[model samples]
Structure formats: C-alpha cells, structure tokens
Target: MLILSLGRAGDMNRNMLMALVAIAPLCGCQTSNQADYMQIGYGPSFDVAHAQCEMQKGSVDQGYIAIGSPGFVAGAGIGNALGNLAAEDQYMKNCLILSGWKRAPHGQGAAAASAVAAGTPPTPYGIQRAPGSWINTALLDWSDANNKCVAGDKAACGTRAKLGARLRAAGVNPAPV
Candidate 1:
C-alpha cells in the first residue's frame, strides 16, 4: 500500500509540473500584481483597512507558494520564490475585490464601479448603502488587512472582527444604508 501511494503521489506531482509549465507563459505575460495595474486611488480621509474589514465581513484565506524552481541551477529557488510572491499578490487582489474594492480608471478608462456601485445587487440579508468615498477607503483598508492576515498576523483578525461589529451597528460603507 505504501509503495502504491508513493507511485500515485509521484504521478500527481508530474501532472502538477506539466500544468505549471503549460501556464507559465500566460503567467509571465500577465505578471502577478493584477491589483497594482488597477490604479485605484483612495483618499486620505478614509480608513482603508478598517472599512474593508467591515464590508468584507469574512476572513482571508490564501494559498502557499512553492520554493525552488526546477528551471534554475545557479539560483534554483529564485523562480519558485517569485512564483510564490506572485500567487500571493494575486490572492490579495482577489480578496480585496470580494470585499468590494473597485479598480480605478486608468487613463482612457473611467472610474471603475464596485459590485454595489455597478448595481448588480447582492443578497438582501446584509446589504448596505455607504458613501462611495467610505467604500473606497474600506476597499483599501480591507486589502491591507487581508495582506497582514495572510502573513499570519493574529491582530489583524481581531481588528477585522471589531470592524464587522461596528458595521453591524452603524451600517456599512458604499453608503451605509
């Protein structure tokens, strides 16, 4: 049974390697910092991390990056290290987006709308209507908090919980209705 399991594990690893290689080109072209490309501009007045914590109302969960790239001999693990960072960066961006962060307009583009601003309309249970400014601040704050949380900071988790409580009482940003 042990031998059989080892064989399966090796097969799985081979498959993963193949997939990673296949995706490498796309990853290279796209770079990992999707959020940085977004050009969001938050104001000085808003408490970005706190607000994001309130609006998101959830915990941050991110994936781990593998160390040591197979391709390198001189600095074998550098590629893998970078890959891990990219993965984490993407994770942070996605986390913030889920928490209602909007991507700002880039040059030709106009200011991007968040889920609420877009009016896609979410479930009625915890809906809120806060000012766009506040929401924007929260969006940034949430991202920072999420980054800290993913980095294994326990205090950030507590902060998020506190923010959630405050929002529950006062209402949420994006126009706390």
Candidate 2:
C-alpha cells in the first residue's frame, strides 16, 4: 500500500508539473504591485502605507493540485488558483482601505492625482498621526507592554490586555507579540 501511494504521489507531481509548463506561456505577464488604489498628493506617504499593507497581508502562494492521472485531471486546479487570486486581490484592497487609502477616480492617472492638493485621510483605527507621518501606535504600545509582561511585570500584562481589547474593539486584530 505504501509503495502504491508513493507511486501515485510521484505521478501526481509529474502531472502538476506538466500542467504548469503547458500554461507557462499564457502566464508570461508578471503580477504588478501597482494597484488602482491611490491617495492624492500622498506620494511618499502612499508608498509607506502600501508597504505596510503588503507586509501585513504578505504573499499568498496558490498551488495547483493534481489528484488522479494526468489524462483524467482537467484544468480544475488552474481555475481554483484563479479564484484564489481574486480573493487575494480583495484582501489586498481591504488592507489598503483599512490602512487609509482611497481609489483613484476612473481615467485619472496617478500623476494627475498627485498634481492636485494632498487628500490625506484621517488616521485609521489603530494608527496615530506623527510629525509628518502616521505610525501604528497601538502596535508599538502593545510591543512595549508585552516586553514588560514577559519580564514579570503584572501591571504591564494588564496594560497589554487592555490595549489588545481596545484594538479588537476598533476592528484591528492585534497579532500575538
């Protein structure tokens, strides 16, 4: 049974590779980080927010799974991967909005938008506006409190708990420190 399962796994991998090679030509275009979302006159600030969103969301690797023989496996995996890409795009959009970005108007290019007055939106839920920039204040406080808590500071632990709850109340999910 083990030997048979190994043989099947090898065959499935081979099929997946073949499927990828077949579609390689069609996927020649590389994915771009340049999205349609834009904040007017937020040149450097926009770059900063985009980087933060990318870091928080990270990258999703959608794999093509092959089950049966190559002949029996249709392009189901490719379709699934495409669906996942759509979902990932949505997630990125949500992250950008949550990070305080707005979509550019239709037919309005980034250059045109930047030429207009700055339209920086209010700081989002857990972030605080600093001198000339915005910062993740809640995350910073949480980190500090977490460090103190790890060092046996009971009050710091309570502070960390309160910060976490506050962030959750504001619709910000604070990951474990």
Candidate 3:
C-alpha cells in the first residue's frame, strides 16, 4: 500500500509539472499589446480637456465632475501614469492644476459654501437631483405661475392669487388681501 501511494504521488507530481508547462506560455500572454498600452497611455486629450472644461463651467459642472466616473477613471489613470514619468511630470502637474485637481484657496467647495452662507441658491444644471428631494411639485407650479405672470398672462396671476388665498385660509400667512 505504501508503494502504491508513492507511485500515485509521483504521477500526480508529473501531471502538475505538465500542467505548469502547458500554462507557461499562456501566462505570458499580452492582453494589451504595445500599441494598445500606448493608446491607453496617450489616447485622446480632448476627453480630458472637455472634462476640465465641464468642471470649470460652474457649480453645475462641478457637480458633474464630482459624479462622473469615466472622467475620474481616465484622469486618475493618466495622472498616476504621468506622475510616474519623470520626463512628463511637470507638464502633467500643470495639466492637473489647470483641471482644478490641485488644491486652491478659493476653490469650488469653498465658493459653494460661501454662496450658501450668503443665502444664494445653487443652480442645478448638470447636477443630479437628490433622490428624496427631487421635483418639488409645489415649487415647480409656483415657478410656472410666476413665469406666466411675467409673460403678462392675467389668468396665471389670478390663479396665483387663488393659491395664495387658499394658503392664507389654511392659516399659513397674514391672509392674501
């Protein structure tokens, strides 16, 4: 039984050796060719530039920058690669600075906070609405009514007055006169 066990172990070792030999070449397989790696390294600057532009466009665009995945991935990969490259590090640093990735005293977050403190409402352009606070029907209707009144529609003004009256009747205000 010991002799049989020894023989089986030897056969298993041989099979493992053969499997390793078979997989050696495959292990060295280049998923990304030289050209592909180069393309990945330096494919297009436009997308990056566009991303930067969108970020600098304002709070709306900044919100987009905060949430956008493709741009973040591309930027991070490129930044890491360039950061490793001694020759292009300076240029990449400048690019990153220009793209607002670098720290700044009066950057977007600070500016936004200041604006909020100043009682200014942030505009949602490219920014996504939060799930729970999405689409305030009352505010939308109020805005629509205001827009119609601004367009000189007497009916909208009357409708707005009626809404005000209803709110006043509900003990909400000093009663719409």
Cα lDDT of model 1 by residue, 1-177, tens digit? 011122345655665576567656655553322222232332221136325543443233333333333332212233444565466556556654544443333531122223334753222112233346555445445545666776899998676566655554556632211
Instruction: Write model 3 residue lDDT over 47-137, tens digit each, in one string.
Output: 4643554344332211112222333433443343333343333444344445323322333445534543587533322132222332333
lDDT of every predicted structure (CA atoms): 0.42, 0.57, 0.40
Better candidate by lDDT, 1 or 3: 1
Off by over 4 Å in 1: 1-47, 50-74, 108-177
Q: Candidate 1, overall lDDT? A: 0.42
Clash count, predicted structure 2: 0
Residue 168, candidate 2: Cα error in Å is 33
Q: Model 2, 1-177: lDDT tens per residue? A: 011122366776786687788667646432423344454232345567677765655365455554554434635655655566566667667766665565645554344344433653423321332223122567667767897898999999999999888888877877763
Per-prediction TM-score to the true structure, in the order listed = 0.26, 0.42, 0.23
Cα displacement (angstroms), candidate 2, residue 66, comes to 4.6
Off by over 4 Å in 3: 1-79, 82-135, 169-177
* Reference-based lDDT, residue 117, model 1: 45
Report the lDDT of model 3 for residue 56: 40
- Tell me the lDDT of model 2 at 175: 71
Best by lDDT: 2
Worst 10 residues of 3 by lDDT: 33-42
lDDT of 1 at 72: 27
